[model samples]
Structures are given as structure tokens and as C-alpha cells.
Target: MTDLPFDPIQLMREHPEKMHIPGGLLTKQGPQDYVGGVPAITGTLFFNDAHTAEVREAICACFDEYEVIAKAHLTWLWRAEPPEGPDKFVYEKAPSMRAMIKRMNENDLVSFTYVSGKQPHDAGDWEFQVFGRRGWEAKMIVRGTSALRFTMPLLHVEKNPAAFQAMFVSFAKRLKALHGYGGQGLVLSAPRESDNQPFEAYLANMLNGLDVGEPVGATRSAHLGIKTVSWLTAVNHKMIEKIGGLSAIRSELPMDWFALYDYGAGLVVQAGPKPEGAPADQPKPARLVLPNMLFKEVRAPKVSLHYASKEGEPRLIGWGAEQWLQRFDVPEDEVQAYKARLLDEPKLTKATTLPDRL
Candidate 1:
């Protein structure tokens, strides 16, 4: 698909509430101006034709009985996968397909509402009209397999997290019974603060820490990470001083460096003394420590960090090694020598002081 021009700045100027912009710069607006009337809860569930009728009935019944839902709709999605293999799933017109699906959803929702006895009182009031007509679309798209999607316009229940959780849990339970014992399902809902933007965009802004008047997302996050490490180091020094210096703490804790390795953009040092008991051949359990604060934060698809547990096998950490490296300030040249000493060289002597400063 051709890349359409997307000017976030222009969007922010026109639709201040939708984009992340400063409050001071915005017009003097009241609560009603920015109030997103009702939250839309939308998600997809995958199941075969065996449970289709029962699932649809349960969903419709749930919407009908639940007074909290102002309007709701459920539909099936037909997805087409690449015939070559499961590896390359990217379609040529993927973006266009998404845009088309969104438009079709809006149009279909309007027709569905009218047929279902929830016609809007004021057609001129675009906001109110659109609210009742917000739902997911049923369409064939290139990528993945077929699934069912449900969209619900939640009433005042959006303001209360506990109530929303309970509602979804009950809804899930009812669907689970119809889908049978081990069927897969998921519930998606936007937070109360999210102002009617695409759910993906809202989540992206949140993870990048971009809110009103805040610094531009990723850059701000990187700066804050550096500051955090500096602050923590200063605090560590002060605490050492208060407790009669590093020597005193070291005597009690007795930590020893085990191994060091260059992980992504920074270095990771395995620290802490070997665990007590067990077989001699067993590897020591040490905490993975980041030792560089200036490393560039890496955010990529399907990349993460794996760390061994104290008891069980290794577990995956969501953020990658590069992102984790942003929490320290170790020098580049010292990394190789540190690794050599910890892994190749024999133990020299035990000292009652902290590891050398970065």
C-alpha cells in the first residue's frame, strides 16, 4: 500500500483532544467538550462453526440484558493467509485494507442500529450518532485465519475499573461455556482516559509516555532512563555513607561478580554470590544487572530478554536487552576485560568493597 501523508502536528492542531498536545495551548474548553461519552470494548475470538450459533445467541443475550451497554454488535472476520508459507504474512494492501475495514464498519454499524431498534434521535449531532454506530466490521482480509469480533459501547461502567473487570469476566464465563472447555478468547477495552482514538494509537502513546504537555515520547523516555540511573547511583552512595561506607555493606551481603557479556547496545553483568547447596556442576544463580545508562532504547517486534529463574527454567522478559541497558553508565572499553576476568581467569581474592564504579 502507498504511504499516505500523516501529519501528526496538523492533526493535533485540528483535533486537540485526539492528538497529544499541551493543555495550555488548547482553547478554554469545558469538561463536556473533551468528554468521551462511552467507552467501546472490542475484541476478537477464534472458534470453529460448531459453536457459532450458541456464541452469537449468548453475545446478543448479554448485550440485551446488560443495561450498561448502550449499543453493541458482533461479526465474523474472514482472513486470508499467504499460500507460500506461514512466514511472510505481510499483504501488499494491508494499510488500505485496514482503512477500508474501518470505513465499512462505520457504515454497517449505522444500518445495523436502525434495523435493531436503536435509531438515533438527532441525526445532526454527529458525535451522538457516531457513538451508537461504533462497532467492528465483518470482512475478508489478507493475513491470519478467520475469527469473531464483538464491539460494545459501555455506559457509565467505563469509569469504574472493578465494575468493568467483573462485567467482562462474567461475559467471558458465559462465552466459555458455549465455546467449550479449552477454547481461546480475549477481551479488549480502552481505558477511561483514552479519548476515542484508535486503541493501538492510545496504547502506543501511553507506552512512550507521551501525554499532554509531556516531552515527545521516545526521546523523553530515554532522557528519564538516564536520569533515573544517575539518581539511583547517588542514592546508593549516600546509603553506603550512612551505613559506614561500602565495606560495611559488602561484609554483610557478600556479593561477587560471576560473568559479564555485551548484550545489545550495553553490557549485562551477572552479580550476587552463588546460591547455597546443590550439585557442584550446577551454574550459579545471579541477577542480571545492566551497567550502561546511555544505550539507545531498542523497540522492535518479536525481540525480548530471557533470564534464568532461581528455581525453574529460564523465563522471558518482555523488554529486550537493549532497552534494559539504558539503566546504567558503564564504559565500553572496560566491558571486554570485565568478561575475561569473570569467565576465563581464576578467582584472585575476596574484597570487602563494592565493584569498581562505572
Candidate 2:
């Protein structure tokens, strides 16, 4: 397996500076091997408020906690010169993690990307991004909100999901996240502009459970509501109130099937014991219906196009991307049918019993 092109961890460990990015890895492997074998799990949270002193501190602390478990997965950051200068996107090395965070605290709008490799843009095994649109309040129309996101190896998550969940809850508690979701997500080489998008766009269409995510667009477009539901979904107090509070949600979604955790200012709903990327081509929507109900309640404001098309290559953009985001949407006529099915399913009472497939 170490010899395989998809094994980024092995390559990174062998020659830290000479690692291949996701696009390069894809070039060396077939589409099935590339998308199916990429071992990354992503988590993102959106904040309505600015990256204030308290919020910045909490963000750094969460990163520290994650570092303890990922074991030095972050090594370098892409920082612009003159830390307090006007908006500029440059990948300069930071003097230290503490210093980099201090600079982040000073700025109103910041874009920070931390990679695991020694070099700035090396195809590291893990990555963290903090895009703050803190100064948008003064603008005529607020475009994007602040967002904090990270991607790491799935093996770490499998080994200790509790630790990761604890960290995720801490983020929601301290940051006062408006809404967020995390689970099986792709970590592209160039997240903003990557050659892997065509394949990602393909897998996104095929997998109902995979999170086809982009923090920047999500922060911008999801101002009205959540983007999508995943293994873990976090919604703040305000959002919960919109859908009739915790009591109403509990009544609609049975506790026996879904586990809900209170994180001070919000709640994190766990869909199942483990993350699943159920095939989108399947006829049955058994595993998707439960979450689909919650998704419909939240109703994502808009679904931004995740991939840009080349002159002639296969891709999902425009109408195609919008259709994929609404893949779980039940037609108005079929809504009652789905609701009836959900009501008839028995809740799992035994520890070993499978969760309700609503």
C-alpha cells in the first residue's frame, strides 16, 4: 500500500518536502482509485460574529487540541507579508504558530491556510484553513461570514472519533457557530482551484453521504440556513429557535435514532455511529431519509458550484451542481409518503439493533 500513489502519508513521511499534491496523485492513479482511496475527513464551522479576541483564542485552542491527536500534522502556514497590511493572499512562512495566531487576531479579514508539509504548498497529509470575513458589516451587502475549517486523515478519526467530536463541540461552544457539518469530505490539493474537481464532482454526484464542501462559498451562501447535513450537524441557539427549539426537534427526530449533544450555545446532532458515503445511484433512499427530513427543515439558502469546467472535460457545474445539492430533496407530492414511512419505522431499542432507516 505504501507503494501506491494514493498513500500521501507514506510519501510525506519519506521526504517531507518532496510530497505530491492531490492533483499530482490523481494523475498517477485511476479515477476510482483516486477518489475511493483518498484518506481525508473534513470538518467546518461558520461563525456570524467576527474573529474577536475570545473567538480567536478558542480557535487556536481547538487547533492545539487537534494537533495533540494528529501529532504535528500542521507544520507551515501561508501568511501574507506585513501581517496587518491590506487584503493580500500570499503564502509567507510564519515565525511561529503563536506569532501567526497573534497576527490573525489583529486583522479584521484574514485568510490563513496551514499545511502539514515543510514547504508551503507541499501535498501534506493534513490542512487547516481560517477565512475571516469579519469586516463585512460595513459593506452595503454582506457577502461572506467568517469560517474555520480543517481536514485530516480518516485513520485518526476512526481511532478516536470521541476526541474529534469533543474538539468539534468545543469549537461550537466557543465560536458560537451559526451552523456547521462534518464527516467524510474530500481534501483537495488546491482547495480554491484544483485539478481534482472533475473527479470530486463525479463522486459527489454518486455519494449521498459524502460532504461536497467549500468553506468560503458555504460561509457566503449559507447565511440564511445550513448547507447540508452530515454525520455530525451543529446548529446554534438562533437556528434551533427558527425550527421551533429543542423540544420540537426532539419530537420530530426520535432520540433513539439520533444522538443530540448540547454545546452551551448550540446542539450537535449525530446521525449514526460511523460516517457513511452511501451510493447516490442506489434505488432506495433508506439511509438518507432521516437526515433528509432535517435538511428540508433547515433548507439551505443556496448551493454554490463547487467545480469549474475546463473547455471540454467532464464536470458538474451550473444546473448540474445545484441538482446534486438537492439530491435528497423529496418532491412536494412525495413529502407525505416519506413522512408516513418515517412514522411507521420502529426505533431501535437494543444496543445492537440497527438505527431506524427513516
Candidate 3:
């Protein structure tokens, strides 16, 4: 594919919403305008079928012509430690897309939604569209108008290494073609089973951070997304409003994220002992996810993190704020010093002792 001239300055001036900020507000303020509204495309193809190669080719060819940009997305890998084999996954069986098509004629293996940078955003709610390779095996999934609508946290695809590799390699080859052309429309996403070692490795090299931003359909989602602002943690609008009133908050944080928390409890030292006591009361790291003011104010409370397994391989995903409390674990005998206040304290006590008092 012929390389196209893509000028940041010109594009930004023409369409400020899509350009980086340098000479204008976009440079400083960031991309406020969103423009990615091509109804996402999706289709299910059998693992080994006559049409498989054509589909791969078409997707690849189209990718070569796409406008490239960086976008963040959810990615996973499931390759086992190889003993002494070629270390290749699924592509070998149907090396050539042509072979894949032929294999399809005999028996097909269906693939779930092999999403693109563009597709995941289209299937908001972070849903995945399923597409199986063949029709005979139960693995052959039926195509739907929208996404597969599976529950959250995604399905881990560890056991099915064989099928996972086949789907991933073909999908990745297509991605590499796009990368070669600077394609940036899709956010890399996959069901756990479909992403194996080789597939994950290739993606790690191609993508730097799991957190990124790009035009998703009509809107733009910063590649690394803001987890929905958690009620227990900060990231709540009302909390900010109460803190210093709405005027003090920045126009926006790079992104917003929320964590799901449940009521739970852990050991807390009732009080420290004095000289007469043996060092004081006992305390431990409490497994509590409470709406305490202290936790919310901590800077860089990130919901998404960077990940890289080995030294040379590209970083995949990393740990975000990871403190989930189970509801069943609440202690029967613990007590709160005081319940959280939404509209400041009742003002029963004197003023100077309070921290955000006017």
C-alpha cells in the first residue's frame, strides 16, 4: 500500500477536534471533538473455509488504507510454556489464508467477535461480538447484529490453546498489515481463549500501553479508559462538588474511572498503648473499601496500569487500583469512628480542627 501523507498540523487546523494541541487549544486542552462514526463492521467466518482467506485479505487490504492513530484497549494472552516445539500457534495448520479457506470446506472452527480498534467502541458497554470459524463444531458461533453481550471481566480463554492461536494469528497478521500502514482505528480486544502467547507477544510489541485514546465511532474514548468513578473511592461528581464546589475542579481529568466496591471489614487498632502498655494496640492492613476522604485524595489513583511480562516483550496490561472487598467479609464487631459526610459535617464542633473549613 502506498504511504499517505498525514500532517498533524494541517489536520488539526482543519479539524481541531482530531489534532494534537501545539499551536492551538487542542495542543494544550486536548482533543475535544470526536469524529469516528462508521457503523462498525462484523462478520463470522469459519476457521477453515473457502471464504476465510478472502475475508482476511479484504480486512487486511482495507486496513492498509485506514487512517492510523493510537488507541488503548483491553488485551490478553494464554500461551503455555513451550517445551521444545516450533512455538507457533494456530497459523501453521492454515498457513496461507487460502489453506484456511480450504480447511473450512472440510470442517470449520468459528471465531467469536474478533474486534478491531473501531469495533469495541461500537460495541460500547464493552461487549464482545462472537464469530465462530466453522458451522459443524459447537465452536461455530452465530453472528449477531451487535456484540455478544457477555458479562463483565471477560471470559478467560486459557484451556483452548489450539483454537485461540488459529484465530489470533490470522487476526494478528491482518493487524500487522494495518500497523505497517499506520492503522489506528481499532482498539485491540479479545476473549481470553483467543489470545495465546505468540498473539499476545506480537500485540505487546505493536502496542505500548493498554491505556490509549482514539476516535470510537461518533465519540472519542481515551485509549486507557476512566473506570466509571467509584462511589466508595473518589471519581464521583458529587464528591468534587462538595469538596470546593464545582468551580474549583478542572474542566476534565485525562479520563474517568470507577471501581466497584462492596461492604467489608478488617482489623483496626482500637487505640495505641501508652508507656505502661506493651508498645500499643495491634493493627493490620485492613481489607476495607470505604468512602474515606483519605483514599480519594491520593494523587495518581489510577484505574488502569501498564503491563509487560518479560524483559524484551512489549508491555501488555498492568495493575490498576486493585482493592476489591467482598460483601460477605464485613466484621460483625467493628464500628466506624463516624459515617462519611456528603455535605460537610453538621458543624457541631468548633471550626479550627476541621481540614477544609473556610
- Model 1 regions lying over 4 Å from their true place: 1-44, 66-68, 71-155, 177-358
* Ranking 1 against 2 by TM-score, winner: 2
Per lDDT, the best of the predicted structures is 2
What lDDT score is found at residue 144 in candidate 3?
12
Q: What is the alpha-carbon lDDT of model 3 when measured against the actual structure? A: 0.22
lDDT of 1 by residue, 112-159 (tens): 111111121111101110011122222221111112233332222224
The full ranking of all candidates by lDDT, starting with the best, is 2, 1, 3
* Model 2: per-residue Cα lDDT at residue 44: 86
> Local distance difference test, per candidate?
0.24, 0.60, 0.22
What is the full ranking by TM-score, best candidate first?
A: 2, 1, 3
Candidate 2: clashing pairs of residues: none
lDDT per residue for candidate 2 within 40-64, as digits (tens), equals 6677888865556666767777667
Candidate 2, superposed: residue stretches over 4 Å from native = 1-37, 80-93, 104-108, 117-125, 136-141, 283-287, 332-358
RMSD of 2: 6.8
Which of candidates 1 and 3 reaches a greater TM-score? Answer: 1
Residue-level lDDT of model 3, residues 247-293, one tens digit each, is 33321110011112111111010110100001112221121212222
Which pairs, if any, clash in model 1? 292-328, 293-328, 293-329
